[model samples]
Target: MKLYDYPPAPNPRRVRIFLAEKGIEVPTEAVDLRQGAQLSEAFRRINPQCVVPYLVLDDGTGISESIAICRYFEALQPDPPLFGKTPLEQALVEMWSRRAEFEGLLAVADALRNSAPAFKNRALPGHDDYEQIPALVERGQRRTKRFFDVLEERLAHSTFLAGDFFSVADITAFVTVDFAGWIKLTLPETHINARRWYETVRARPSASA
Candidate 1:
């Protein structure tokens, strides 16, 4: 099995961190997003979605989306229980993971994609391109700040996004926190709980994966 990845991209990094946490190593081929490598006909045939963090199984079936790929690996090795050990834990992990993706990661993506010249007409990822909405930049920034606030509220009471144990929710939240840096957004100093949680997760060895 192989993973098509772009190392600098946030979504791919999510899968990388997940694999690291699971102690599973899959061979990877770098798809250069900056150079439009993912848009190539070769890559399009492999993944019609034309996105990075794609996994191709030994049977040649392709999996797109970071969480989906992570889920596949989780099914392969359930020891780490990144998704969750119990039904309630699984629901919480899914809830917070979606929150991280929508409230945090997508917010950052909106700002970056709409403001970066490199993105141009490619504001959204996938097969089709959408023109950037200049106004969304500020809106995205505002939403990202709100996401930080939301995280602060949640972390102030819980050790991790889901609960006591680190799970996929933490992975998504951790990646989103770092991705915010690309847009020059940061967790405010006053968000002590969120900042503390960030530092704790940042210290994990898998964070660098």
Candidate 2:
């Protein structure tokens, strides 16, 4: 298996952290997304969709999305499991992870893509060029506040996102919240649960990778 990673990007970090936590190592190639290397013809050949955080399985299966890559790794390395141990746990983990991705990460991304001058005319990923809309950024900011409120409420009730144990849901939330700065958002003092969770996860060795 081969992993293509860009270190600073949260999506790739998700895979890297997962790999570190599982104590699994694979040959890797770093794709410089900042210089638009992922948009290059060669990288495009490797992944037609042209994205970092892509994993090429030993079976020649290429996984592009971060969650998909993490799930594949989870299947390959089951012990010390990160997803869940039971059917119900697995389902809830997926449920909360999806919500966090859609609500948290996507909100940050929308703000960046629409507001950042460097990302001008590129509102979506995957080589598409669209006109920037500043209004979208404003909307994303509002959505992020609402997202934090919801996440704080959920997290205040449990140690992790899904339940008592650390799972993929926590991973998704961890990365998304850390990326809040791209949208000029900050973790408020009132969000005690979220802040505590952030500190706890960041102290993990895997998170430092």
Q: Best TM-score goes to which candidate?
A: 1
Q: Quick one: best lDDT, which candidate?
A: 1
Model 2: per-residue Cα lDDT at residue 49: 86
lDDT of 2 by residue, 1-209 (tens): 89999998889888888888889887889999888898898998899887888989789889889888888878877977888888988888989988888888888888888977777666877866678888888888888888888788988998988888888788878888888877778778999998888898989998877
Per-candidate TM equals 0.99, 0.95
| Residues 97-169, model 1: lDDT tens digits | 9999999999999999999999999999988989999998999999999999999999999999999999988
Error of 2 at 67 (Å): 1.2
TM-score (C-alpha) between model 1 and the true structure: 0.99
lDDT of each: 0.94, 0.85
Which window of 10 residues has the lowest lDDT sum in candidate 1? 71-80
Candidate 2 has which clashing residue pairs, if any? none
Worst 10 residues of 2 by lDDT: 120-129
